[model samples]
Target: MTTEQDSRASDAVQLAETTTQPSSVVARTSTWSVWALFCLSVGALALTALRGTQWIVSDILIVDGLTAVMWVVVTFFSGIVHSYSRRYMAGDRDIERFYARVFGFTLVVMTMTAANHVALLAAAWLAMGLLMAGLIGHVRDWEQAQAAATLARRYFLASSALLAGSLSLLAWATGTTSISGILAQADEISTSVALVAVSAIVLAALIQSALFPFHNWLLSSMTAPTPASALMHAGFVNAGGILLTRFAPVVTLEVAVMSAVVLIGAVSALLGQAMGLVQPNVKRKLGSSTIAQMGFMIMQCGLGFFAAAIAHLILHGFYKAYLFLSAGASVEQTVPKDAKSTDTGVSSVAIGAVTAVGAGVVFATLTGKSLLAFDSGTILVLVVVLTTLTATRDILRRAVLPATLRVAAVPIVVLSAITGYALLYNAISTALSGVPMTDAPTELTAAHFLALALFVVAYLATEFGWHRSSTRLYVFLLNRSQPDSSTVLTTKAEYNDV
Candidate 1:
């Protein structure tokens, strides 16, 4: 009798599992559909490139560098996420719905990217938000997922409204609805009109990109499935960068607008990075990282480095997508271990400083470009130098290789990174050469220097406090991240008394 009952229970469990599993045929169909879309988008991108940047079909469609680039990125990543979701969400009852929503969102984003007229762009932008809500709440049974979806929709709605206002102003100023037309008349548009439009665009981009206080929705969105997370971080979050780049001509008209963007972006970057350090969950950590990265990208746009921002957007999209997709394996690799304290000796600090400075000087000399020639070039060199040095130091200190091999590897890695960045930057600059932009104002340059100095000072302070186990700042960050133990204990005691 006991054996019979056990067998029946096992059979019931298996049946439940099978019923919840996604249909193999449905999964295959979804994958193939995305693949077909990807192929079509790629072909369209090539055609657009061949025809040059212009409106097609009577200003109803745009075929420009931004459109071509974004189409390739969105379609490629959509296909990837679709294929990934087939396995990741295999047993999900809503797997079919998830796939449909992802495809729908991708289509809407593509439409937005290809929109020549402001009205079409506005419509597509709003549609993207609606579709995104469905994708975010794919697992509607979860309360957290539903809440995240709601929050995301709220932010997106506000963003859409601001964008609409900007578009209206542009249309009114230019006497035409065409994006190209408005941009062409940027010089003739009254300063007040341009300022209002540019300010609206900046505000819209900030909220859309999840900068600073507006970033909570993005942070809370990790409750979605892995594929959804990947898509959101890699594609959806990049909409602001795309929008700013598309309107570079008009946006660069006002120095004050760019300065505001820079200030907001700098704060977002700093806060995001700090908060990311305290997050215990891997997914949430990545979310914080995305906020920081988007902040930096926006800062680049504000500095009139639209091409550099585009490059950062594409590269970061691919990188963050891979990180999210493989996050499970990463979790396994991150089993808790005893923390080791590394002494930041004067010698080591000196070496790092020298390496960073030397790398920048070498790169500048090799490229035959003056550091002051372009703000983007200067900032890129500083970033690459700092990153390469920091990475080299970390690797060398942790690597188990022979002394000579480790020493050799450092230079090889640093040189390779510098070369790759130089080549990539050059290519992006060439591709976006037609886009009109201006040099950042002197005030903005001063602000950038101030922000950089603060970042460096903060880094040094953190390093100095690393060995102090009782550091107040460290404890505060940790406590803020963790649940309050006192509240939990008090609640338990009260329940016992009751």
Candidate 2:
């Protein structure tokens, strides 16, 4: 936003231009393909939703509104990304596997999002691990493909051990892995055992979020397709926050634990964001910012603001997806070098709006029952909505608009606004009523799924509406141009494809 920031942003653009073609998969123009994949992704989500809600988890667990909501968001975007890939990843070598891997990962995320037992967690985690490996290995070239596989495998292996360790600790003390049952007996886990499980889970989540010491995998993952990057940053990576959110009430009930989560989240948010500002890679910068924001959301959960955490997750997920898509479109395509001196033009205002909402998350955590808290949260939700709308505008303005998005954009935008409004209003009312916003540790008791329906609808609208030719004004609104050299460096490195 300042002169210094502007120069840094330009430098990032130059750097991305410099990375001719890394050993990565890029989807060239192809419509019918994206549509077909989008359909399958949606079907996968729908199936997962039905599976999560309509039946019991064998003899182990139950599914509720939270499961429903998580399924919807993950599924919707998985589909949207499918649609986006049609145009963005036109000439990719292994397009068939791209579709398969994405759809496969969609199911994996759905399973994880809906899991209510430790066994389920292990199952879902393993499935996701395999998919992560597939996604990384799908690239044709050895250097990139191998890097992806190796990083993904390490993530799987390490996180698997962490999952097993946490489960063993919880089972040893609580006697079962059912989330509901665990929460019911969370008080029985004695402080010592509780401390151990908390540490293991927290460490695991940090890995998933790619925070600080555990962030290299995210950087290494840049060699994947733009769509894969979109999925990782906007959808899957967010799962780490969801994990903390689901289990937060348990920790929050333990005062020391809650405070620790809050502190860690705040620190991660601040540090990750600062690092993002300096990274030149596009996807990397975005990924770092994601980790930071996720920390903010996780902090909200830690502070007993479960509903607000869900709000953050759902809102951020959409805009983040759009942004990844934007980056994918920019970098994957071979646009004329002399097309324009800088990216068309993007809005600082939109970025400002999203940042304001992130700030609201902090305020909400600090003043759960105060008017200031409610107002800040409301403002933050609107920032997300506005950015989604601006994204729609940008998408529509693109030289080659993806068909799936064009069809779904308007509704997605409208739905996002509606759901955002509802969540903000609910947050305000609950805070005003002096409700603490948490009922237990394992899951949100009042996670209204219909609201998630609204979230999915709004995103569909934006993806649909954003289909016009790129324009100077619209580009500026969406952050296509004008950044400082430092910001540019961070962003360029962030985006391997772009």
**TM-score: which candidate is best?**
1
Top-scoring candidate (lDDT) = 1
Residues 1-498, candidate 2: write the lDDT tens digits.
999999999998876653433223333222334445456545644554445433456635444545555666777777787766665554456676787778778777877866778888777877787787677667655455565677767876787678778877887787877766676777778888888788777777777776655666666676667777788777777776667655654555456565566556655655565455446567777877787777767666554656666667777788888888888455554546653221123443343334335433434344333334333233333334444454444544442434444445444454455455455635433422212234223222222122223344434443443313335434432342222222222445546653
Misplaced by over 4 Å in model 1 are: 1-21, 24-26, 47-55, 333-337, 341-347, 358-369, 374-376, 438-444, 465-472, 475-498
What TM-score should be assigned to candidate 2? Answer: 0.61
What CA RMSD would you report for each candidate? 4.7, 14.8
**Candidate 1 structure lDDT:** 0.75
Local accuracy of candidate 1 as per-residue lDDT tens digits, 1-498: 699999999999997776555576767776787788778777766665566554466777876667777788898998899888766787777776777788888889989988889999999999998788777777666555676788788889999999999999999988999888888898999999999999999888888888876887787676678898899899998999889988988988888778677767777776666666777778878888888889888987876767667778888899999999999987655567886534235644565566667678776665544677656456546655655565556665666666656555656676766666556655666555455552232333666676566556546644555514546766655443332132122355545642
Q: Counting only residues 3 or more apart in sequence or on different chains, how many pairs clash (N, Cα, C under 3 Å) in candidate 1?
A: 0
- How far off is residue 375 in model 1, in Å? 4.4
- Cα-lDDT of candidate 2: 0.59
